[model samples]
Target: MTKRSFDQFFKNPRHWREDLVAVGGDFSVDRLLYAYTHGIFPWSEDPIRWYCLDPRAIFDIHRVHFSKTVLRKVRQKKFRISFNEAFPIVMQACSYREKDNTWITPGFIDGYLELHKKGWAHSVEVWNAENVLVGGVYGVAIGKFFAGESMFSFESDAGKIGLFHLFAKLKESNFELFDTQQLNHVTWQLGAYEIPKLSYLDRLERAIKDMVPWVIPLSHD
Candidate 1:
């Protein structure tokens, strides 16, 4: 779809009030980037539903908080932290971790795998001392904006550790936005908050205009 048509489709007033704004589109790299850059995202498959939440949730990068315990665990370095080392594995783990309901279907995985190849998608992986994959967080980055897709953990505090590292990197790299889509318990505890959709769209517009490199080392020492 052309950029003009895609923008026109989302300009409908109905998209402003509703969470599920539009439906039926492929999760192509261009489509995904367009959606995220415009504050919209794909939530489900089987025809593929697109959504833009009314009260969008995001982390104010510098304000993200980690409890003393999590901070200490991070300091202990019991788990290894790495960026983009296990994109597909992390995405698949998030999909199956919630067996009853998962929006990360095969199509979604395929789409993001392609995005990763193009350097627009990334994953922060947490591995135990035994080198076993225990937790991870994955997301898409466009310019200075990052939209966190999902996270999963096999061990206690593992996911939070990965998340902490991601936030650190975003702040270090001077990112402007860290969109979390919606508020869940984990995000709430970590200081994710909501803003009006229009306000989020405004921020997103300016954020994607500037270039901010994702410059973290592939492996954390």
Candidate 2:
């Protein structure tokens, strides 16, 4: 679909708020869930205008590209990948890595924390040999849908490692889709694509229908 057409569909907010409660106030859990299911989400910093974009970017698990460089890094196993071990830390790192204020406001973080407690949000962490939290990614996982939020890295290729490992495991676990929300050059290089907003909503609906419990093991090698 053309970019203009994709941008048009996300313009409506008739049913955005549950009962006319302004969405820009805070990132409530209910609103987060509604936004995800409807192909809209909170992002921008202005609370008064809370941003949601169109032509959403996503990756089909089977389509993720692993380059030779990434493959070599994975094979070397220089860092360890663990799931849910340092969720809050990962989120904080992603937020603060640039040394700037972030879109994942305190409200968003708290809301996601609740989602994690309920098994909806998940985090994949990367640790160096010293077991230091070098990089990671976190997002909401509803059934076959994994809505990637953000990632950060302190060491070279650390973020990529987390991403590749996450995709690899999700594929092994039979995940159907990985939604990156909006694609950038980096994500596009990693095989994410933009789809018609309506198509995205349809896929999201189908995915969330058969909710799969993401079982994260407690130990790692």
lDDT of 1: 0.87
Q: Candidate 1 lDDT, tens digit per residue, 179-201?
A: 99999998999999999988898
How do the residues 70-179 of candidate 2 rate in per-residue lDDT, one tens digit apiece?
A: 78988998898888888888888888835568787776777788878778788999999999989899988877788899989898878889988788777766777678
- Overall lDDT per candidate, in order of appearance: 0.87, 0.74
Query: Candidate 2, 65: how far from true, in Å?
Result: 1.8
How much does each candidate deviate from the true structure in C-alpha RMSD? 2.0, 6.5
Q: Which candidate number would show the highest lDDT if scored against the true structure? A: 1
Model 2: per-residue Cα lDDT at residue 46: 54
Please give the lDDT score at residue 42 for candidate 2: 70
**Any residue pairs clashing in model 2, and if so which?**
none
Question: For this target, which candidate reaches the highest TM-score against the unseen true structure?
Answer: 1
Question: Where is model 1 poorest over a 10-residue stretch in terms of lDDT?
Answer: 211-220
TM-score of each: 0.93, 0.82
